[model samples]
Target: MPTPSEDGNASATAPTATKCDSEHTPQPQSVCEPDHRRSVVQNVVLIASVTLCMIVNTANLTGVSISLPTIGRDLHIVEDKLQWIMNAYSLSSGCLLLFFGRLADLYGRKRLFLCGCAWLGVFALGCGFAQNEITLDILRGIQGLGAAAAIPACLGILAHTFPPSTIRSIAFSTFAAGAPVGGALGNAVGGVLTQSTEKSWRSAFWFLAGMAAVCCVGGAFSIDKDEPYQLDDRRVDWLGAFLGTSGLILIVFALSDGSVAPDGWKTGYVIAILIIGVLIFALFVVWERYLERVQNGSGTRRRRWWTPPPLMNVSIWGRANGKLGVMLIIAFLQWCGFLSFSFWITLYYQNYAGLSPILTMVRLLPMNVTGFLCNVVVALVVGRVDLVILIVIGTTFTAVANLLFAVIDPAAPYWAFGFPATILAVFGADFVFAAGTLFVAKVCLPHEQSVGGALFNTLTQVGAAFGTAISTIVFNAGLTKASRKYGVEVHGSVANAPRPAQLVAYKDAMWAGFAFPLCGAILALLFLRGVGVVGHKTGPKVVDSDATTNEKTVSHPWPTLLLVYQAVEDR
Candidate 1:
């Protein structure tokens, strides 16, 4: 095996055996190693290609929202069934993330990435051709599965390829920028397509399909190959995958379907599914813990068919500083606020403001533009500033933005309330997302990078689903109350509600949206303190005389904090 030098370059010659090695058997070397070096242009191409994939994925997420009304109208879809357009994608994507992340590590990042791109392209085209709501929903779910496969591998590839250097930081920043950029483009493109008489909503799906195809071709040529890493004697956790996916799907279904259920939350099917989902989720946690203990235990015992390597490194969460746990919670809450804003704002423009799809996109352009511009600033300042401080600031902005939305009148002028709110909301989200991604990447070990990325995105999707469900519930309740009070004829759907009822329901839902970010800000302030670096020692330490003279130990005051802070700055 080639030995790595101080600069992380692998030497061609193997090290000569010393007298000490002859005296005592040497330890086995690790199977994993970095790939052969590539030129600067190659690295850029790779980064750009992966960033394109990210753009396509995020664009699909937000772009579809703008096209929903058109799609529902064309397919004759009821309001109750409309949620599935987004929920199917979010649910499948969220549930399969960890499974695919682990699979990428066990197989190969490049292989899975290619497969995912192909799957994404195929299904995206399928979605464009879908004849009915059911077909479209199924296709969208499959498309999400493809996205889940690609996302983790993209992150892992970036993490492994770049290392801890300026290039790596730039790569991550560029990657981070894709979300907002794609979202902006998605909105613009969706609106333009929906307005086109010939293609309408289906045009958006065709565009995504073409984008994915280009990315797949570019990725195949650009990304460098690496050997797959697998733990000895361990196998894939099929049982855990089944339980986790099923439970999440059930839970999301319960929450989303409750909005349209005959009896709402108290509906027998909704209540039963919710209970079963909760129980199954509880069982999934217990099963994961059991498998974890087995993996960590001494000696090779007879392994059960259900047992597999743990999906996540439980130790990462259980670390003394608890930064990982805090980050996870922050991601969950922020996404809740972000998605609530994204989904409802479009509805507000359409139903209350009485804007066309193109007009709604035009009005919401400020948020997208702000998000894109702020991400550029984040890319510039990320490493120099403290990550916790960035997070706090971002969440603060998010809370304020949501609060503004909660109080704004339906007739409020664009410049007065809408523009400022848009700017603040997007700015906060971009900063938090960019900083949070770098923090997780810096903290995780090389092998765990894919899973780390998976965890981050899983929480994001699940949080979005949660936000949509909660907002729908609140909005529906408000509509019912307002209708009864004013004696307006009530329907089960928001789209069918009277104008006054829609406005009232939306105001109440906006208040709930405000709470998510506020809670996130409070949590960050209370728990996010001090930088804690894992695996590396901090500060100076005395050297022992008996220790080898060539051995070196580098330390920082708090290594985790410094590394993450530096990582952000370098970006």
Candidate 2:
């Protein structure tokens, strides 16, 4: 935001005043990355590097999921505890995202990204060597901290590396493609490794470790360096950070582990923790609001030295004709359904159908294949088609995927229901991911891209965790009810349960997943009706939110930027 101080007008002071490499001549205070600083090759390599970061983190999550059953059996873990394998990762990553997102914006994205990669790799290796369930879960949770940092940084870099344009949209689509591709590959490769008695499922962690190390090296070499932060929002909101991060950790922990508690949700500890978490979260919001008001000059122009900017930039909601705000809410809802559906699909193939891990992988291959094609389609259509159509249709596909599987008979041929469901799942997930990330790149100011990326991912990742928790709760309840009907006992492990009860449990879980995305689509259809045409909003790096004298709103920038972009887009 303090543009000319670091990157701008030192060159202007020169007597000769030679023209810059950029098409536009250098202005005293404007900021522009010199075109000559990055070659076309550098840009491609940078994209590849950042995209690989997304792939590895996503694959790390999905790949470990397919191995959950295997890990449970080997580690003698119960069915209830097995979900922790996934929840722990999601919890750590989700809780820490906003903190690291802001950090990347202030300190540097490339720096945070590289550090995250190295941390992830080391811990992934630790996970490979873990001897028991507790050790593995602990390692996995720590590994997710790396993901929280790296993902936001990756998105932040993409936002700056390429400005808003059709080409940027395609680049974002490629980046978005990483999630489905990683999920698909994680399953295929995880299955191969899991089915083997030699490498076993632990090898999946090792594989992730190796890839993380590779990506770290590539990113360091490719990502462009950040300018000196001589002037920026360097103040850290220590109290807000503590409240926000700790509150989230407590809430997600309660949601994740509550179902398995001795007395379930009624347990005193669970009730206490949940209540405390909610109250603390409320306080965090109040604190952030107070800081925002002060910073925006509503209360005082000379803010206290202790005060700092809010963890999340509030104006992000108004970007893109207020579509960005709705999109984030939609992100949570759609993604809540996504990973849950994928997780159950794996179990449906292996646990229900009695197929080997490799065979399960084969059954799921169609989804990944479709996901690849869907990525390409989204890239092609995102700029050409109306975004509202793409979002609603894509979200609906995911809901349908869950519904189809919910009613399917395990004895039925794969082609009858499973084939279409898997394919539909990919299309739904990929489309939403590409469109969502592209909007972020276009909507967020250059300085706030990391926080924007973090906000989007915070919803999506936390939604995944919440979805898993809900499915697990519904699943356990269904198993108990159906087991009673079938005159059987459902234990901590489903392996010993009756076939009828297990089948009913899977369907119940799938139904929960179905409801989530359906809600997302309805929300989109209703609120997004007034959304402006999806296009890039280009402007200065930093604009004050609310100006004094009440003449201009300086505290929010997107409101004005939206008008500017809409005017240009209309023409």
Candidate 3:
């Protein structure tokens, strides 16, 4: 065996290597370089494994919707209480995301990711054996906590592993595609499991548990090991975590409970909690700002108790173009539309259209299929096109789809309104999600990438919760009114209600749903019109060469806007 030397020479008698010189010495012949092919294979495995985890988590989010009615009947849960099953998961996940994201960055991403997977599996199994609504909801909330821990860590790993390039863009796009894919699969699989007389709704949870178990074991081997970054004196912001999580949970509780409470929003408890939630959120902002000031003032000196760094970069809020702000708003609105429509439409198909669970899945399958295809298309053109235009087009399609559903006749053929609406909704959702995620990854600084990813997912989960809550309120109110008008008891799923009552409730709720995407469209037009990707040119613009030695001037923003609009129209 030959010994290695510092000067790339193999010598029988090399001078004894000192500690300082050893750092530069090449390894002996027995040591081998990393195999590029093996590393590539590992990267592929890691991507697939992380993507599977995402699919399961996202699937659980929506898969339970189709099973809600069955679960309600079996567990003897009331109409209003059934909403909690879904809300519990979303609210918990949404509230805890920021805290967990920061924790992952401070600790270890792979460790957190594995622990989260384990938590998900355990809770999912608990849900399978749940005997009542309370048990199910509690277990679901824990499952969501697991999702909160895993999702951002997985994203951070991806961002850290893949450098900023087309590869990263494609990877993010592929990961984003999991949202629609899992959602669609969740609907389809949940329907299948719930429809089976032998397995029933419990089988869905078991299925989730199985998938999570697979992810945990696979992730343990596939994910690369990385050490936690050292932060000398910075600490986790426990106070901020408490305030923010509590505030979000309380707000979601108020929203979900508003329609069910005796006095609605006027109920003293509801009103009080709502106020407290808003106040806590306000306090959270104030505390974070104060911490920022303290950190700035300290300048290199460590304090005994200083505010930890914020979950998100405060500067992201002040970007001149406001791209991140626009993206977040758009994400919130899009999920609001998507979740409400998906939930209510499932009810519409099962109750009003008299479709079986399997049949409902069949009806909804087109949207998922279309969504997957559209995601592939978006990933190909994302870098070349203006994302704002894509957003506008997507929101427009979503608005139009909701409007179609609002006016859809109970007796309409599958081809007339249902099919077209599903297609449009899928296209709209896939485009916004895929493009928005890629855009966020591109715009964020390397250090804050995980935070950015967490914020994006937080908006999504929060938006879904808000959408579900608002839709529940509107649907319950409309159901109550229709029941009173028809002199029937308001005691069952809207699907099982009298035809007249069902129609009235669904149409009213659909009208409310239409407003969300419309608002998204308006916001995009107003704020996102001039924003472009960070590194991409904003179309062809006239430049003033002598404006400054270091700066280039461009023509008016109107031409860029026009070009984007034209491009969208042409596409």
TM-score of every candidate: 0.85, 0.85, 0.83
- Candidate 1 lands at a TM-score of 0.85
RMSD of 3: 10.0
Question: Candidate 1 residues 107-149, lDDT tens each?
Answer: 8788889888888889888988999988998899878898888
The C-alpha RMSD of each candidate to the native structure, in angstroms, is: 6.8, 6.2, 10.0
What residue pairs are clashing in model 1?
A: 382-568, 383-568, 383-569, 384-569, 533-560, 539-556
Residue-level lDDT of model 2, residues 138-233, one tens digit each, is 988899999988887776566555544554555665676777678778888888888885869879888888888887888877777764243335
After superposition, which runs of candidate 3 have C-alpha atoms over 4 Å from their true positions?
Answer: 1-41, 160-174, 298-304, 313-315, 321-323, 441-447, 489-497, 533-571
Supply the global lDDT for candidate 2: 0.72
Ranking by lDDT: 2, 1, 3
Per-residue error (Å), model 3, residue 177: 3.3
Candidate 3 lDDT over residue span 1-571, tens digit each: 1232332123423222111123444332111221233366666777777888889887886678888877877898876677788888987888788898778756778889999988988898889899998899888887899998998777656644553345545556566567777888898889999998576888988888888888888788777665665455448889888888888888888988877787777989999998999999888878776665555454554444555776555555433346677788888998888777887888788766778788888888888888888866774576577877888888888877888889998777988999988888866677777667555644443234455567777887888788878887888888888887877767435635678887888887787778887898889888776555322333212111111112222211011121221222223
Q: What ranges in model 1 sit over 4 Å off?
A: 1-44, 160-167, 298-305, 321-323, 384-386, 441-450, 531-568
Worst 10 residues of 1 by lDDT: 539-548
User: lDDT values of the candidates?
Assistant: 0.71, 0.72, 0.70
Tell me the lDDT of model 3 at 83.
70
